[model samples]
Target: MQADVETPDYLRDAKAAGIGGDERWSIVDHVAANPRAGDLIVGSGGARKIRFAAPGRGKSGGYRVVTYYGEDDLPVFLLNVFKKGDRVNLSKAEINALREELSHLAREYRQGVMRYVKGR
Candidate 1:
């Protein structure tokens, strides 16, 4: 697989490449709002949790992407399905980006989760 996979903003971010913040926020919130995103946060670094899904698709009915980012600074991204076949799969590149973005977001979330957890 390509190293570009799962590396966010490594090349061109969905927003910088023309995608908007509102669009990115839509999915992030939608995923967080949905149960399909699950309650399991992606990494151990953050106490705060934001969830997401990468469907490698566009406006599909079956695919829902769950992404994790900081509680405050959520990564800007949206799952765009470029093709459809017998199965659903996200690109390694996209996963990488989401991961990168999620890491940044998780930091903010972590702080909040920490504060909230500690009753600070």
Candidate 2:
């Protein structure tokens, strides 16, 4: 089954990082095809980090996408996107904050599903 794709507000700011429209589409398509693809970033609340090649650019000069796929039933959450080398690895404190925020996000998403089903 193809997982639903979702780009959060932060990810939508890809333009700021030189991620063009076509490149974004490619990233979305690739993630949808391979939902579990990417290296799991430990302590980031289940976020998977993937390297994506920009149009005409190899992976060395591509982008990084941080995503969260909470469950098979849920949509793939594009957490953040950035150009390579723009930032170093996240610190422990950053990961801790992200973990908490992601946990809250997942809870809200799941609750929304339940509410929808109950209403139906």
Candidate 3:
């Protein structure tokens, strides 16, 4: 089954990164087609970064999509994105922060699902 998707505020506000409505949908479609397409960052709260070619740009000029798929049961969270040269690598400190936040996000999401299921 295709996993549900979630986009965090940072990514949603990346207008400077050139992410438009079409680009966003393209990303959603890409991940929905292949949820495991991205390479897992060794550490970053299970986050993965995937490359996406823009409409006229090739892979070299593509954008990087940072996402987190905690498990089979959880939705794929689109955490952030940036152009290829916008940033190089995430720092250890950033990853550590993600670890803490994503943990809480997962727990809350699970609880929300359970409540919905039970309420139904």
Candidate 4:
């Protein structure tokens, strides 16, 4: 099934990383086609990290995207993105914070969806 991709922070991060439109769409398409394409990030509350090749750069020098696929009911959330050289790994504190944030996001999203469905 085609997955829905929500870029909550991806646009800003991609712009900051100098990622162009084509590249951005490529990433979204790939993720939508295979939401579980990335590896699971330990202690990230189900967040996954996927590496994408930049236009001319190989995967080694590409961008790393942080995504969360909490469940099939929720859209795949593009939480963060950064160049490989910018950040290699998240610190313990960072991981904990991400876990909490993701939890909140998932809860909020579900509530919002439920409200919408009821209103409809």
Candidate 5:
């Protein structure tokens, strides 16, 4: 199935990482085609970390994308992106914040869906 991908923070992140044009779309396309392409981050409330290679950087030296796929019915959210060397791992506080953010996103999405269905 074709998955919907939401990029709330991706635009800024990608611009910061010097990724745009086809490179940006490629990342979104890859994630949409394989929602489970990344590894689940511990304590991230369902966020996954996926690697995308830069033009000549290759996967090992590319960017890290943090995404959340709460459920099959929900759109995948691209939370953040950064170069591999920019950050190795998130701190405890960062993980906690991420969990809370994901929780809120899921809650909001579900509520919106409910409202849409009821309206129809």
Candidate 6:
């Protein structure tokens, strides 16, 4: 039997309902602080930068991004699918800042990607 892999819309709705701004942000910060552990700087095509990446994840059609969620799977994917990796051996504030910045950068990156793709 093919187990359902697609994320349910109810889950999305539940998430939306369950997490307010600060709660969601705290969860994001916790994930980034703990599981993901670190971030890497990446330059976009427009010379803009992003946070969090493993080395060889740059290949193929994959994105080298820094998303807030995906704690359980991303490291595995980054390690197994890519090369070159590191975690922050820095202070909590620094890691928190990096995670927060990564969250912002991911938003900008997504907008930029949409614009780029739509323009082309």
- TM-score versus the correct structure, for each prediction: 0.30, 0.84, 0.84, 0.90, 0.88, 0.28
Query: For each candidate, what is the lDDT?
Result: 0.39, 0.77, 0.77, 0.85, 0.84, 0.34
Worst 10 residues of 3 by lDDT: 4-13
Cα lDDT of candidate 1 equals 0.39
RMSD to true structure for each model, in Å? 10.5, 2.0, 2.0, 1.5, 1.7, 16.9
Ten consecutive residues with minimal summed lDDT in candidate 4? Answer: 1-10
lDDT-best of 2 and 3: 2
Instruction: Show the lowest summed lDDT stretch of 10 residues, model 2.
Output: 1-10
Cα lDDT tens digits for candidate 2, 26-103: 788888887788898899889888888766777877787878888877888887777776763566886888799888
- Cα TM-score of candidate 6: 0.28
Q: Residue 86 error for model 2, in Å?
A: 0.9
lDDT of 1 by residue, 63-114 (tens): 2233333333344223232212223444456456655655565466558768
Off by over 4 Å in 1: 1-61, 69-87, 108-120
lDDT of 4 by residue, 4-110 (tens): 55565777888999988888888888888888879888998999999988777798899999888887787888888999989877778978999999879878988
At residue 97, candidate 3 shows an lDDT of: 87
Can you tell me which runs of candidate 2 are displaced by over 4 Å?
A: 117-120
Kindly report which residue stretches of model 5 are placed more than 4 angstroms away from their true locations once superposed. Answer: 116-120
The candidate, 2 or 6, that scores higher on lDDT is 2
**Regions more than 4 Å wrong, model 6:** 1-88
**Alpha-carbon runs more than 4 Å astray in model 3:** none
Pairs of colliding residues, candidate 6: 40-52
Best by TM-score: 4
